[model samples]
Target chain A: MLHFKAEIKENIPVSKNHYLLTFTPLAKTPVPLPGQFYMIGIGNSCDPLLKRPFSILTKSDDSIRILYRIKGKGTTLMKEMKTGTVINVMGPLGNSYPIPKKKHTPLIIAGGIGIASVFYLAEKLKGKAIVLYGARGKHELLMLDELRGLVKELHISTDDGSYGKKGTIIDLLNEFHVNDKHLIYACGPKGMIRAVSEFALEKGLKGYISLEENMACGIGACMGCAVKTLKGYKRVCKEGPVFNIKDILW
Target chain B: MNLEVSIGKLRLKNPVMTASGTFGYGEEYSDFVDLNSLGAVVVKGISLTPMQGNPPPRICETPCGMLNAIGLQNVGLKKFLKEKLPYIRNFDTKLIVNILGSTVNEYVRLASALDEARVDGIELNVSCPNVKKGGIAFCADSRTLGRLVSKVRKSVNHSTLIVKLSPNVTDIKEPAKAAEEAGADAVSLINTITAMAVDLKTRKPVLKNITGGLSGPAVKPIALRMVWEVSRTVNIPVIGMGGIMNAEDALEFMLAGATAVAVGTANFINPSSTSDILEGIKIYMKENKINDISEIIGGLLIDNPDD
Candidate 1:
């Protein structure tokens, strides 16, 4: 619900093409909950006209962190910014991950830059959760030091054998003995999330999945990010960026 | 500073309104902006029956705009009347519902159902293809657009009718003229221009629908030109929209001929865009010492002389 220029406190390169940017608000704002996102307007031109959506990676007392990968022109512009750059950001948008009422083990699933929101979700969960993170290689795994202290358990998978188990993260599912009793919160590429969602359904596990789609208004105004479900189409920017796996129609 | 503007019988508090499909019922961005501060709110396009719409990837960002083939996906009449309308009725701004249908009867059905409700106006969508029209949009032909507008106007007598014209047509003025002649109170343009994009690496269409409507700042110039042309062709008021991101952009359209302006794709960049544009317009009016906004409407001065 805010749009202002935030000064980049630090723009750290986490890995190849991936970056972790932290910014301090020039103005006061409310704290963003985990899974919430911001629409970042790139530069001052119209070439990358649409503000790219980025999830909250983590937040401190005064700074908001965003984790991103250089996938296209938008991110390419982001990667070139220096530490003192001021960027236009509008935020705390869409629904946040709901705090579970019932007592159940939290199983965090992250794929690549999908790891953006998990750190905050884990902090809220507070060392009561287990993390399953997947990347292409060792260098792709980000913020391992920050995550290790916040979670009770951590599992890793790399597509290339240069890191952990050399396969998709879905291959590492059995180690957790995942079931209806465990809660699964996943974010990743569609194929990976789909496989995890199907596996979760098959095991009768319950959790939410944060989806990504090309969008216009990150708010519900533009129906650009509609995701199909049993009910019908829902806006990924409003009704979710996080939705119950049981409700989504793959 | 008399910001009031009108379209037929409906008078707005200001000339600022959010374009349909961009503001999504007002409440979505209510947290970011005050809904009562604007002139009006045009909700997303609604249909007679429920629509599944086109599949994902529904949108792709182009140079300065984005292309989307949402296929006018929306809650049906029953759900909207039961669920959405009541919630929207509570907001302070004028409520204009943009409606779409595959056929003439479907349009009538939707109009009749929404008639006499708390809604203020209905925007008929003739931009997209109809099943009965064999893939041609009604607005593509003046005759068909006139027939559809007249019939819908007859069926729904309670609210003002605004015809939203598509920009893809070769001559936008013809459709605007047809709507004006067929009892439409006003006309709004331009609906997204038909466009498409591709993924060079994957060698596939960027949007699953293959082609979509292009909208955003990229379409502003073209939209301004069309709004000017339509304003000259039609006798009724014109609600201009395209890539109106700020007050200056809105002012350009007003001077061109649009009595009112709607912020479309710009809403995505800032949820408070409508009010921001409203504030911008007020600032401009103050800076120029203008007392009334109507004086600027259709008042663009051109230096080119007739041949």
Candidate 2:
């Protein structure tokens, strides 16, 4: 609920048009939860009045980082934002992933850009997590070394065989020996989520999935980002951008 | 500072108003904002009876705007008066009820009910573009628009009646003049424009309703143009709104001849936008040495209509 003029610390192009922009908050940064997101805007264009939601990549005192891909006009403009330029940043909004108790082993699965949210989750669960990541190619598979440093084991998969296993991330997860003793967390393409959701259910594993939707108010007011669930359609920005894999209708 | 504003004889605590539909009866945003700071809250479009509204995929994003096919989804007038009005009155802000009816009688009935409830004002929402029936949206035609307003005017004795005009018409001035001729106390112009979006992969319209009203920064220019046009065409005060996200945008609407502007899609971006716009207006007024906000109404100089 606070709007601070943040200065861009760096905007690094990762692969193709994807970028990781780090910003220094002009105000006291709220302690955000894992899997939570922030709404960011470029300049003063009401054309994109609504802020673009980016997952909290990582955070430090007085600063926060966001990883985004150039998908549309808003992201395109965001890529051009120069270092030292100030932009409006709001929130550590939406619910975060629930943390596990002592000595809990959690399996984290992510696909492509979905890896952004899980990076922080791995950092939060350091030494007590296993990571399974998938991307289209070697270059698209990001944060492997960083995640490898934190997890007990890091599993990798690529569609083009340019990386570890030659199949979807779900394929890699299926190949790996995982049991009900471990809790699972995933974020990525809807197709991948649908695939892995079945695997989690078959194993009777408790898991959480982060869903993406075209949002108006990142807050609860608009009701623009309602996702169909087992109970009913709920606001993705409020009731959850994160939900139990079992609660999801997909 | 006493930050209240007035719409004709009705006094508002501030110049911030919740545009119709987006605020959902002022009860929804109460948790996020102080209702008293707002000039007035215009609730969702009300019909004679309950409406289920269009099916989903009711909203889609365009270039800079979003198309919504809420279908004037309302709780009807009787339920609104019996349940909704009392709750709204409990809030510390002025409530300007927005009414939509398919016939003149329905409009009169809805307006009379609001008068009986002793609400602040009636914003005749005759310009709803999401309906498929005749008389459901009277502002599309000059004669029907006049008839609807006149009927409500005759029935409501004390409340100020405003005819909200439609932007879907060829000439917005025609309807504004019609409402004024029919004895409307004031007029608001430029409701959402008729629009549709497509899903390229599915080869189908993105929205389930096929067509929806477009709003946000994309519609600001067109809204301002129509507000300027309608302000010149009619004698009544014009409350202009469309894509007003900041003080500058609000001032643009005022300069285009809107005495006060309503914040719609911008509210979706920031829950505190209404209060922000009100504060922004005050800053602009002090910086420019302007005492009254009405001085800025219709301040934009147009050498020719073609511009």
**Best candidate (score: lDDT):** 1
Q: What is the docking quality class of candidate 2?
A: acceptable
lDDT of each prediction vs. the true structure? 0.86, 0.81
Writing each residue's lDDT as its tens digit, candidate 1 over B249-307 gives 99999999999999988888777888999999999999999989998899899988874
- Report residue B220 deviation for candidate 1 (angstroms): 1.3
What DockQ, between 0 and 1, does each candidate earn?
A: 0.71, 0.24
**lDDT per residue as tens, model 1, A187-209:** 99999899889988888889989
lDDT by residue for model 2 (B107-129), tens: 88888988877878899887777
Task: Report the C-alpha lDDT of model 2 over A1-250, residue by residue, as the tens digit.
Answer: 3555689999989889689999998877678989999888766755555678899999878678888988877898889889999987777888999997665588898999998988899899877888889999999977777778888888899999998989888789888898867788899999999888888888888889998877776776555666667866676888888899888876
Candidate 1 segments whose C-alpha is farther than 4 A from its true place: A100-103, B129-136, B304-307
Which ten residues in a row are the worst by lDDT in model 2 chain A?
A219-228
Per-model TM-score on C-alpha atoms: 0.94, 0.84
DockQ of 1: 0.71
